[model samples]
Target: MSDLRDPAPYDALLLLSFGGPEGPDDVVPFLENVTRGRGIPKERLKEVGQHYFLFGGVSPINDQNRALLEVLRKDFAEHGLDLPVHWGNRNWAPYLTDTLREMTDAGHRRIAVLATSAYASYSGCRQYRENLADALATLEAEGRRLPRVDKLRHYFNHPGFVRPMIDGVLASLADLPEDVRAGAHLAFTTHSIPTSAADASGPAAEHGDGGAYVRQHLDVARTVAEAVAHETGVEHPWELVYQSRSGAPHIPWLEPDICDHLESLHAAGAPAAVMVPIGFVSDHMEVLYDLDTEATAKAAELGLPVRRSATVGADPRFAAAVRDLLLERAASERGIPAERCALGALGPSHDLCPVGCCPARAARPAAAGADSPYA
Candidate 1:
């Protein structure tokens, strides 16, 4: 595992993500991109856009991604890994197609992509692959050559990601009133998807149908909770909960939205609670709106003290993790036994998705040369 590639094989690293609006004017259009396929009316979208408007129509995701890009660039340079890094999004300016075209034009033939999402659900995993397919098709239509893109393995269990959540939990615990902190329960939160989609996620294994998604999140939450308890000597009870549900009411997604859980905890006489967003890589709109605004307000109204841990953004450890992943992929490509890091032990994600992994309704034929791992 200590053996490293003499020279990195990757020519570039692409940071792929779901883009967000940068200002009040961009909110409606951003929502449109998110809901393009869904037949939801414009009026309903406007109402939803109000969430972004509340925060000056800016999504922290893009900025966070930019910060991550800079961190990766600096880390790579420091390590003498001369790979140039680029950023692209599914929607908004600097679209994936344009970014890929730029990279191709710049003469990058072999590239690696690191998606912002860290889980195995359809939207989290498969959709990114589909987007890559679409981008490649767009490039072909424009008579442009597409580069070979390989996605990094998911890093949910990596110390770089998980340790930050544990640190966040400890900080949140310290912010609470002393007595309340002692009695605080921990609630690990993630975005909710339809139960069916969760069931169809990842390769079949002994862990159950949606094993990949569910097990990854559970492990992250448990690891953070255990580390926090060990560090602070607080035997806080914890549970995983869902947030930012947007589907039809009757269709069940993940259970116990953060607000509802807070109310229940309050009614059950829990003095305070801390929410750790184990399913997210950064504090995007969902984290800002759901946890910071909605859940906090609910807890306040119910006389329950609540605190949310910070998302991993530009953490040095995370930068190191990304570097390690690239090295592992490069070594594997060279027929070397890939060294197992805390993150790499999760195993390399599928370069080409397995049949029926993360099945989507109205599934379209996958475009050729899609670089997404899910594809």
Candidate 2:
């Protein structure tokens, strides 16, 4: 592999992410920002916002992102890669537009982005691109030049990403009571999207229409389960589950909610379960509330031992993986031999998304710098 320090004239690395409320006062408004066009009542949002309130109305995502930024900076310096990293959130202060302006003011002409999401669906991918476009538009309106930005491919199947979660699952299993560990079932979980959106995910042809979300989650789960079995000499069964469904009741979303799956597992004579949040990078709102609170309560009702695995927040392996991904992309751009890893037989994602990839029903404009294989 080419050294990460190869002289490529990229200006900076942007850590793009879904922002969360930082305090009790920001909760309702932040939720409002997230659900703006959905027309959900504030009272209803308050009910949902209780999850944030449970932990002093703060989300762990921002701190996690900060830690990742530091790791990237330190690793880049150690590897002789000279670049500044700036962070911008999709729905909060230090917003994307402002971040872009700062980068422009600092004389950055070319940028590479690493979105927090690691999948190929619209929300997970394209929407961030669209958000980038919107942010650029705002910057252009303010008479600032927009830097050309490229996003890295999805790292979902990268060993740096997957291996840490495998370790997390094993650790969680070990923490459970011995009796519980004996009967534990692995539940792999992710966000729930509407069936239509899910079906339309990924590039046209080959992958077929939709279902990318489920397929990706399954791939991660199976890989982790296999690794767990290999490391512990235990053959634990696993199931794919969904959480964080925010769509209307009239709209059908992903099935077998984590709680529901836990109930079914208990009924099937399983003594305990370990939840692997395969879909997320950290224990944000969904993992903290849906899994820790809701799913644990359900398991308590069924007298089943339940433990949740940790997210890959600031794991050194994950940080190293990010470093490798940047190096890999740079090498590929230069026509060098680049090492690519992927889940199952899905292969590598496209470097540039094709027209009409992961089409949205109520189509939003594509974001600037949104084009990538993962998106």
Candidate 3:
């Protein structure tokens, strides 16, 4: 597959995602891995486990990651990008540390990480970096060769990611009752983190705000909603709302939850609604439980029609976008000019995160940052 085009600089591509339990027996342990160091009691763990219990104790994320991994492999093959593709999770089997050990043993020196998250936030960006840091630290303790890993830029406004969401929302609008389509409300949904986390997301600006997370979502929401209106002629009213809030009640998070947003639409005489999971890369447990089950149940009780649009799960365009980003990063490493593609207010985020970006509640080494000692 080699040609005049320069070969990819990285030896491997790692698909980093949040992991989930595979079966009934795996639930508690998986959650323990997720909430490690946070001193939640067994009862609280069981309470949260109920969400998985309702789903037969299986989280769909691993299977979804498998599907995405295959799609990425296929995309790499078709595009003649010969780099090996590997998948690992932060909190389950095929864990990031294990994956890193195997990758280095297989003789891969440099790796490119493509996190499932497409936005900027601690969990979305820094937390993943911290995971990488943890994994790398463990590997170093065992005296393994630490590879240079560069996370790809955020894709919140990437044409490929946003385009599929636009298509999904348009299809959802069309699914509504024809008479109510024009009056339908588009509720763009994403996970809600604590208000403190929200305020500290992205780089800590002197202005003291978390603009990137909210701003990027809103920009993408506007772009998609306007396109959906233009293409479907629905003129749907839309707002960026949040879902999957897990924090304590007193701790504030992004406001106007999806269910609440649905109720507001119903009370305002809106006849139907569409949920665009703009915050997620795929329809994982959050999208399934929150939007499919919980929010749908709420809409049913209100007698309001609702349709949930698909996330950009292994969509060909998104896969292509990954290829484009990889090639661009490879070119940049070689000092070659490569185009950076994005569609909304914020342009492409920096390939290398600067220090002081997305500070955790406390200090820890993070991945893909200026202070990433990995290099």
**Which pairs of residues collide in model 1?**
353-375
Per-residue lDDT of candidate 1, residues 1-375 (tens digit): 245843356788889999999999898888889888788888898899988999999999999988999899899888878788899999877788889999989998778888888888778877877788778778777987666777777778767777777888888999999978899999999988777777777754523555578767777777787788789887899998999998789997878888899989999999999998888899899999999999999988998988998989888888988888788877876778776566323544554455666665766644212323222
Against the hidden reference, what TM-scores do the models get?
A: 0.93, 0.94, 0.97
Candidate 2 residue spans exceeding 4 A from truth: 1-4, 206-210, 368-375
* Regions of model 1 farther than 4 Å from truth: 1-7, 206-210, 343-352, 365-375
Q: How accurate is candidate 3 locally (lDDT)?
A: 0.87
**Which residue pairs show backbone clashes in model 3?**
none
TM-score of 2: 0.94
Query: What are the RMSD figures for all models against the true structure?
Result: 2.6, 2.5, 1.5
TM-score (C-alpha, index-matched) for candidate 1: 0.93
lDDT of each: 0.80, 0.81, 0.87
Considering only N, C-alpha and C atoms within 3 Å, which residue pairs clash in candidate 2?
Answer: 129-367, 130-367, 133-367, 133-368, 198-211, 199-210, 200-210
| The best candidate in terms of TM-score | 3
